[model samples]
Structure formats: C-alpha cells, structure tokens
Target: MEFVILTGLSGAGKTNALHAMEDSGYYCVDNLPPLLLETFYDLCDNSTDNRMKKVAVVADARSGEMFADIPEVISKLRLEGKQFKILFLDAKPNTLLVRFKGTRRKHPLIGEIASGSIEEAVELENELMNGVKAMADYVIDTTFMNPNELMERVTTLFSAGAHDTLLVTCVSFGYKYGLPPEADMVLDVRCLPNPFYIKELKPLTGLDEQVRNYICGFDVMGEFLDHLYAFIDYLISLYRNEGKSELVIGVGCTGGKHRSVTVARMLNTHLLENGQKSAIHHRDIWKA
Candidate 1:
C-alpha cells in the first residue's frame, strides 16, 4: 500500500489535486484530522488484503491543532513502516488572492481578504507551514501551471515512477511529399523501394502486409528497430530522472501516408508494451 499526504497554503488547488488523485484510482480523504491519523493507518493496515493500494490524504491548517501535530503523526507512520510521501502545492500570493476574489470566498488563513492589500494572516499561516513544506517529497508551484498540467505531473509521478520522464512527440509530414522534420531519430524505408511503385500496393494502405514486408526487408530496418528500442528505453529512464514533461520522436519517410504511419504505429506499440504513456496523431497523413 502507498500513501500520499497533500498539504499546502489555502487556494493552492489541493481540492483539485485530490480529485485528480481520485480519478487516478487513489482512495482519497479530504481534510482528515491529525488525531485520526493513527486510527486511519490502522484501518488501512488491516485492509491491505482488500486491494486498496493507493491512498491520498489532504491535511492542512483547516484542522486546527491537527495541523500542528502533523510532524509527529508523520513520524509515527514512518516508524510503523507505512509507505508515504508528501506533496506540497504553492501559488503566488497575487494569484491566490485573485482566485479567492473570483470565488467570493474568504481565505482559510485570513477571514476576509481585501482586494489590493496582502493578508498578514495568510502570511503567518505560510510561515507556520514551513515545517511541513520542508518535509515535502515533491513541491509544485501552481502559480503558472493549469489543472491539466498539474494532473499530468501527478499521474507521471505515480504511474511512471519517481524517475520516469514525460515525452511529448509531434510527428508531422506531408502525404504527397517525403518525410517531415529533422527527427531526433529517423527511419527511411524510401530505398527499401516503395511498394507504392507496385500497382496493387499503390492503391492499398501501408496496413497491407505486402507493403509492410517490402519496407521491413531492408537490413537497416531491423537494425533501426533494435537501436530505437534500446534508445527509447534509456530515454524513458533518463527523462523520468530529469523531470522532463515531454519528448518528441518523429518517424518519417517519403510520403507521410504509408511508411511513416506504419513505423509510428510500430513505435507506439513498443512504447505501450514498455509501460510508457503515449498518443499518436496522423498529422498530414489525411490532409486535403
């Protein structure tokens, strides 16, 4: 079983994060009191057989003294051999103030936040939160990130592991013309002889076996596959460690329609097989 404790300043999107975690299959509890920490752990301990693997708890100053005892509670959980990590979210004061104003809600730290004046109470709360922040395993700045981006980051952390990297690949090429960009990696089967040159294959899609075999016949094809697989695996590990959000790998050949489509599909399959999250777009494959 794994646990994630989320704590942060008011209006930092803790609620949104909790929802995202729930969407990702985490058993989530919002605003749990610190005193119940022991009982909660015990309940989870006894329920490990029930397959409740991922649990998320939102703990913040709203719980009064429960917030103050957070450190000791965390220590106790650690001593009890529970697996857990802390995630802290922080947003700029101006952004937070604007959010509160837009929602017409008072700051949890300050009773009523004035439009232009910075709230001293909120500042004090932040000061008190320093201890928990210091203990955070992951701290996210929400000042510039949107909800979708934040969810992506959170999903990567859990699904991709602590060291997995996120790669965003944009593949583009013209159907009538040849390959597209200077891909960090390129696979050119243009010389494997275009099966498109054949009358039957010319009308058929790259999905046809004759076209696939024609392209794969080249020795370079097998070699490219071997090297590409190894390189991507290494990159997955590398990007995760570097906290990379995206990587783009373009596959192209003469005419994006057939060759590039087939290769991209193959590569996409391999990526999914390796347990990496990915998406594919035909780009110019269907352009007018």
Candidate 2:
C-alpha cells in the first residue's frame, strides 16, 4: 500500500490537496487525528480488497493537541518499515492572512487554545508544524498557485503512472443537460442516428451489443471515427509536447445513454490501443 500524510499551514490549501488526491483515485480522509494513524494504516493494510492500495490522510492543526503526535507517529511508522510519504504545504504569511481574511474563517489556533491575532496564530502554527515539515518528502509553496495548479501539482506527485504521461478523461454527456465545464474538447455526436427512437433499443444502453452494432452499422459512423481517431492521435501528441498534465474530452448527443456513451467508449478504446492513459465516465447515463 502507498500511504501519504498531508500536512501544512491552516490556510495553505491542504483541503484542496486532499480533494485533488481523492479525484485522482486515492482513498482520502481529512482532519485525521495523529493518534489514529497506525490504526488506520493497519485497517488499510490488512484489507483483502485492493481499493485501499493508495491512501491519503490529512493531519493538520485541526487535530489540536493530538497534532503534536504526528512527527512521532511518522517516526514509528518509518522504524516499523511502513512505507509512506509526507506532503507539506505552506504559503507566505501575507498570503495566508489574505486567504483567511477573504474567507472570514477563524484560524485553528485562535480562541482558548492560543490567544492572539491571525498573524500570531499563523506564526505559532508554523512553529508547531516545523518538525513535521522537515520530514516531508515534498513541500509545496502555494502562495501564488490557484486551485487548478495546486491540483495538478498534487496529482503529479501522487498519482500512479502520472510521471511520464498525461491523464485523459472522456466524459459522455447529453447536450440538453449542458456541456461539461472542464472539457478540453467537445465532440457532438447528435448528428448520428438516435437509438431512442427505435422501440426495441429505446431501453438499452450503448453497452449493449445490439446498440453498439446499430451505432457502428452506419457508414457515416465509421467515417467520423476514422477522422476523429486520427485527429485525436495528433492532438494527444501536441498536448504531450506542450506539457499538458491532463485533458478532458466530452462527447455529447441528445441523451447520454446511447450515442454519446458509444462514441466515448470508442474514443477510450482507441486511446488505450494507442498507448494513452484514459478513463471513460458516462456523466448523464442514468438521468431521466
């Protein structure tokens, strides 16, 4: 199992990093207490299922007094031969102050725990976390980074097979429901024949062999896919050269259940066949 502990300043975007890790297929837990670190690792380690192979937990100032135990726990794990990495996030004090002010959220060290201004709280937290920070395998200064950039950084550091390849996500959607906001490229498959009109195929999805056959039966379908595959192959090369870490391709038709799903699946297969890393998701498949 690959275990990762995420820690950092209160306003330094640790939550955003955790969300990014979750999106990258890691089983993530936020605000995990330091005392439970070994217990959590044991649970994940002894699991028969493979889903726990990658786990990330956030241990920050929110753990209060328990936060002090983090460094010791990390040392124990290391001594016991448990493999893990620490990711520490930090930002300039001014940037952290601005973030806290803009969000109007109280600093974790304020009130009864530590009586002072936000600046003092930030400084104190930094001092308390300095030990953990020194042990980090990766430290990200997020003062100038936006959420997207931070996510890319986190994914690049922790995602499997992400070192030398771009991650491609193919989304199947219905135009009527609106375009996916994150799409890098949108392909309209509405021009293809609609299987919803056919009484027999109406209830079936693109995954069904009959629906797949019907969609591929059209000459135009073959022609479109041929050109589409060639274009995407060229585009992927360009994107890789440009250092693009991720790409989202959207395929849309009247409804997401049929044509869009079929086309997205075809695109995903084509990408895999060409040695590209890709994932397919039918966004509106079960919508009424």
Candidate 3:
C-alpha cells in the first residue's frame, strides 16, 4: 500500500497536486479528517479493488481542529510499518495572499486571523502547519510554479513509481456556441470543407460514413490531417517531457456536428495508433 498524507497551507496548489496524483494512479480523497487516517487505511487495504492499493489523501487545515493531531497519526502509521509518506505543500505568504485575492476565495483560517487580513491568515496557517510539515517526506514550495508546473512536479515524484501514463482528451465543439473553457490547446477546423452545405450530408452527423467520406475525399483534408497528427504528436511529446499527466485538446468548426467531430476523431485515432493515451468527446454534436 502506498499511502500519502497530503497537508499544506491554503492556496498552496493542493488541488492541482491531488489531480496530478490521481492521474499518476493514486486513489485520491480530498480534505479527509486526520482522525480517520487509520480507519481509512484499513478500509482501503481491505477493499477488493486493486486500484485502491495506491492511495493518496489530503489532510489539512480545512479539516479544522480534526487536523491538529495529524503528526501523531503519521507516527502511528510509521510504527505499524504501514507504507506512509507525507507531502507538505507550501508557498510564500505573499504569494498565498495574492492567490486567494486573485481567485476571490476566502481562506479556511480567516476566522482565526484577528485582523481579518488574508496575509495574516497565511501567517497563522503557516504557524499551525509546522508540526505536520516537519514530518513531511517531501515538501513543495509552489510560490514560483504555475498549475502545470506544480502538477508536473507531483507527477515527477509519483507517476514513474506507479507506472502511470499521460492522459489526453480531445474535445470537438462548434464555434457558434463558444470555446471550450477547459481546453489546454484549441485548433480551428473551419478551413475544412463543410459537409453541412451538402444536402444529403447536412442531415447526417460526422460519424456517418458518407459525411466522413465526403470530407476525406478532399485533398486538403488528407494533407491537413497529416500535418495535424504530426503537430499533436510532437506537442504531446513536449507535454510528456514536462511530466504532465493529462492534456486537453479541442477541435472546433463552424458547426460541431460535422468537420470538428471528424477531425477530433481522426486525431484521437491517430494518437491511439501511435501508442499514445487518448480519449475523445464531441461537445456540441447533438445540438441543433
């Protein structure tokens, strides 16, 4: 069993770190009380699912007073010969203040801060986390790291150990509706010949053989796909080099029912054939 106790001050990128851990094959539970550590471990160990064997959980100030005794719990886990590791995430107080302000989120410890200052709240949380931080097997200071950088750090520490692979999701959507808010990279396929203009193909979705055949019948499409596949293959390699566990690529067209869906599917199939981890979703395919 690989059990990790993730604790940190608020706004220290714990959420991103947990996502990376999840992508790296760790079963993640957020904001669990410290007192449940032993019980949770027992539950996971006794569970039949093999995936639960490698577990990482967040235990922190958000647990409030229940988090006060985490150091003792960690010590008990060690004494029992449980596979225990603690990762403490932190950031400069000023940086933490800036993060909270930018996100417009209230600090978990704001009530404890007499002056009601988020900066002071950071200081108080830092002071409170000292004992748990001292017990950390790894500590990440995210003051200078972006979300991707921070996730990369977490993946670096755990992904290899878990034999995890990078995950990629390709989404297809219509430009008329809106851009996908979650897309890490977006490509426009409006340059492709629109099947929507053809009477027979207009009624059919991109998944239909006739629509796909009509779109692929063009010389431009074949060339475009060749270039698109190569570009994405190269980019995926770069993302892997940076230790990113997942990447979201969006393909958009004038109407998602046709060109975008075909392109996204082609990209997804290309990735799989090239031995890359990938999945696809057509976001606006069914919409009128």
Q: Against the unseen true structure, what C-alpha lDDT does each candidate score?
A: 0.68, 0.84, 0.83
- Expressed as tens digits, the lDDT of each residue in 115-137 for candidate 3 is 89888878888988999987776
Rank by lDDT (best first) = 2, 3, 1
Clashes of each: 8, 0, 0
Better of 1 and 2 by lDDT: 2
Compared with the true structure, model 3 gives a TM-score of 0.56
Model 2: colliding residue pairs: none
What's model 2's overall lDDT? Answer: 0.84
Please state the error at residue 116 of candidate 2 in Å. 3.9
Write down the TM-score of every candidate.
0.55, 0.56, 0.56
Candidate 1 accuracy as TM-score? 0.55
Q: In lDDT terms, how accurate is model 1?
A: 0.68
> How many angstroms is residue 77 displaced in model 1 relative to the true structure, after the best TM-score fit?
1.9
Q: What is the lDDT of residue 209 in candidate 1?
A: 75
Least accurate 10 contiguous residues by lDDT in model 3: 156-165
Candidate 2 runs further than 4 Å off: 112-115, 161-288
Candidate 1 lDDT, 1-288, residue by residue in tens? 667788898887888788778877788899898778768767876794654556788889888655889888888877887767788888767778778788887666564335434466567668878888877766665664567766765665555432234543435344354343323445454444566577777665555677778778878878877887797788768866875544556666566666776677777778877767764544555543
